[model samples]
Target: MRHVLTALCLVLLTSAPPASAQDFPSIGSQYVDFGASMAAVGQMNNVMGAAVRNRRSDRVDSPRAAATTRYRPSPTVSARVRTQFADFIARADPAHSEGLRKFVQQNDLLGAWEQHVAGDGLRRGDVADAMTAYWVQNWQIANKVAFASRAQVQSVRAQVAGALAGSPGFARLGDAARQELAETFMLNFIAQGSAFSDAAARRDAGATRRLSDAAAARFRKDMNLDLRALRLTEAGLIG
Candidate 1:
């Protein structure tokens, strides 16, 4: 499936006419700025303080420390939450989930949610219900954007590419370069979405690392580009 998607992207990249700066339309500059802001927030979240890290280690590593800590959702309940969330996503955005399922699995999500509930002191059932509601609300908004029309999706993609192309670091790149980078961004977007979902469902560092390594390998094999070189953020593709 990864190979198939890569092949399709390659064909699209080769067959499509070179995009002029004018070819990319502006959706809105504010949206682009918002994307940058969101990226910064994500970066901040990634840098955990030493105190917080130690506290988390105590809770996770020491049985005596954990006994005194708050109750957390069990792995079984976490699995249920993930299955429910995936079902909702698959139903709400079948077209998108069709491709997403290849990278993310229920087990991946189970780990992420378990960690979330453990950190937040949330019940698994409650979290599952809350997530279902959250996605249902967002689904309406998403439908109006990409899901509603191919033209909108294309327009948004163009806007994103154009924004990157105009950036100082990427400005020197030609249209082909911009296009290639944009495609890479899109692929990373999909992969990260899956990874984030899994991470959210369960917070296993080893599992997350394995997922990242797998994705990097796929990017290298399929795109002939190092994933690290892209410097993609967790929320980079949200824009």
Candidate 2:
């Protein structure tokens, strides 16, 4: 009964009615391809290790240490991650690149759209959620393209290629495996999107709990996005 009522009060940007107080984790940190997010992930894992062992790195200075010691990972980690994620992306996807270029253009329009619909904040948020997913697709496709031109991605690709070049474990896959992985990601994304659309349709929280399953499904799909590896390469527009 409480669940039904809470669902009605939900902001509806990919959240279900709160089944419990457990926050239906919004795709916030996971969705956006912030640059330092990955490094932050590493840093926090390091910090956590430091705390457990009571050891600190030269890099883990000041408040992060204090905050980590105090058991406040969210605020410290979130700030650090956001900064790092942005920086990494700038390097990964350079200026005028198609994926980076497209994302910048879209984020500008999105920001403008949000301002106009500022009063309808919840509705704007929902649209933002959808847009973020779209950006993820943009990043994946562009990153794959960008990777082709990248020494690092190429190195990884070559290693994978060499590893399986003569191996009996799916050895015949060769480069076809890369194409297959791409296709699989696209297919999975389509299925995930369809589920989210259905979830969003019956978004209201009734006793039936309609679309909760879809929401959970969509959440899982976005969660698997390798967020730490995500790169947001916005050019002049979204500095």
Off by over 4 Å in 2: 1-173, 204-239
> Residue by residue across 169-221, what tens digits does model 2's lDDT show?
33233233322222222222332233333333455333123233333333234
For residues 23-119, what per-residue lDDT tens digits would candidate 1 score against the true structure? 1111111111111223321222122111122231112221211111112435453344334434433443455554333223412432332332232
Clashes (backbone N, CA, C under 3 Å), per candidate, total 10, 8
What TM-score does model 1 achieve against the real structure? Answer: 0.22
Per-model root-mean-square deviation over C-alphas: 21.1, 20.5
Checking candidate 1 for backbone clashes, the offending pairs are 111-201, 111-202, 111-203, 112-199, 112-200, 112-201, 112-202, 113-200, 113-201, 113-202
The residue-level lDDT of candidate 2 at 48 comes to 23
Q: What C-alpha lDDT do the candidate models reach, one value each?
A: 0.28, 0.28
Identify the candidate with maximal lDDT. Answer: 1
Give the C-alpha lDDT of model 2.
0.28
lDDT of 1 at 59: 24
lDDT of 1 at 74: 51
Judge candidate 1 against the unseen true structure and give its global Cα lDDT, from 0 to 1.
0.28
- The runs of at least 3 residues in candidate 1 whose Cα sits more than 4 Å from the true structure, single-residue gaps closed, are 1-192, 232-239
